[model samples]
Target: MLTSDQEIRELLTAARTVAVVGISDDPERDSYMVAEFLQRQGYRIIPVNPRLVNLNIQVLGEKPYATLRDVPEKIDIVDIFRRPETVMPVIEDAIAAGAGAVWMQLSIVNKEAAARAEAAGLKVVMNRCMAVEYRRLMPR
Candidate 1:
């Protein structure tokens, strides 16, 4: 697991594409807001939400994929917004999709899932907001 500010900042710097798992179509949601912020900061945001995919809805101008594996593109990071108990499947998908890292949003932490991701050679960041970290570490 990556815990240091320098490590996290380096990961954020190297990352290009992020898959936002469990993202909501509603703009008011934190998931949506963070994804938008990352997008505006020049990171490619791939919204991952099965519900939105089923409804043929787009989030942040990109169609939401059902899962990370369904993205059909290289994903640098998987930004998770789901509950802690539900993170295992997303971690599995991230590993299968060959993602470089998995980031669990604020208040969402699953040590088991983090371990699994790390074992699969993926960096893990738990209980932190990507937008907050980006703003803090990569100030304009």
Candidate 2:
């Protein structure tokens, strides 16, 4: 787990793109809202939801991927919104996708997945909101 503010900042700053797993089509959902927020903050957001394949590209600027593996380009950060049980496979996919960091959203935590991602050389940030942290760490 990344402990220092600098480390977290570096990860957030260095990342150019984020793959938002389990992204929802509904704007009311946290997944969609966070993805929108991150996109607004200049993180190229690639929304991922198996259910929203056909509408993905039309909605999200970048074409949405059904799975992380479905993404073509390099993924710097993986923002996951799935359940705990769903995270391990997503982490495996993130490892395979060569993402530098894996961020599990607020109220979400998967210890095994976090440890696994960290062991695979990816920075793991669990139980944190990306938008909130971005606000806290980088004061505009």
Candidate 3:
């Protein structure tokens, strides 16, 4: 797992495209807030939410894809906002989608899924908010 300040900072610096799985359309949600923040930081946000996609709701000015595989562009990171029990499938999709890293938001942690993602050669970060890490590590 890449949890060190330097490692996280490096990942944040190198990452350009983030696939936000389980992103919500509501602004009150952390997923929505984080995605919006990343968008403003110049990282392309690919919203992945089946419900929003079905409803034709766009998040952060990008069409929400039903899954990571549905996204056509290369994904640098897969940011997950789902529950711990539901994160395995998202990790699987991230590995299959060829993402460089897997980031599970705060309060979400799955050791087995993290192991699987690491085995697939993807950097894993569990129980951390990407936005918070960005603010802490990349203060301007």
Candidate 4:
């Protein structure tokens, strides 16, 4: 819903560390591929997935965290890959984790959650693809 290219560019340029919620281990998955691309672009990727924690495995060379609260570093952007119905709790966690921004990936949108995040002073972009936005906004 955030349509300003300048704002999106600013947020993406400012972000250095991204915590990818619901990231997958499978490379074929959109979450995994996007996270990988970000990692390759030098973003510190904090993978957050309960399944990965349950499996006790790392993804993309970083230890997988069960939740945003478990991540030690400051999260510049919390990129969510979960369903719209399940995003409120994740946004709450992102706020608690002190993230600078929240990005709900393509096909995922929660107006209430986005409003809450913005009200809490965190920049938000819902129903957009982070990797695509990065390519579009960041200088190539």
lDDT of 4 at 25: 97
Give the best candidate by lDDT: 1
Poorest stretch of ten by lDDT in candidate 1: 62-71
Total clashes, candidate 1? 0
lDDT of 2 by residue, 1-140 (tens): 98678988888899989999988877899888888888989899988877788664444555667888889989999999989878999999999988989999987889999999999999999988888889889757
Model 3 is weakest, by summed lDDT over 10 consecutive residues, at 60-69
TM-score of candidate 1 against the unseen true structure = 0.99
Tell me how many clashing residue pairs each candidate has.
Answer: 0, 0, 0, 0
Candidate 3: residue pairs that collide: none
Residue-wise C-alpha lDDT for candidate 3, range 1-140, written one tens digit per residue: 99799999999999999999999999999999999999999999999999998999999899999999899989999999999999999988998899999999999989999999999999999999999999999969
Off by over 4 Å in 4: none
| Stretches > 4 Å off in candidate 2 | 54-57
- Per-prediction TM-score, please? 0.99, 0.93, 0.98, 0.97
- Clashing pairs for model 2 are none
Clashes of 4: 0
What residue runs in model 3 are displaced by over 4 Å at the alpha carbon? none
Give the alpha carbon lDDT tens digit for every residue of 1-140 in model 4.
35799989888878899999999999999999999999989899999998999999889998999999999889999999999999999999999999999999999989999999999999999889999998988987
- Candidate 2 structure lDDT: 0.87
The TM-score ranking, best first, is 1, 3, 4, 2
List per-prediction Cα lDDT, in the order shown: 0.96, 0.87, 0.94, 0.93
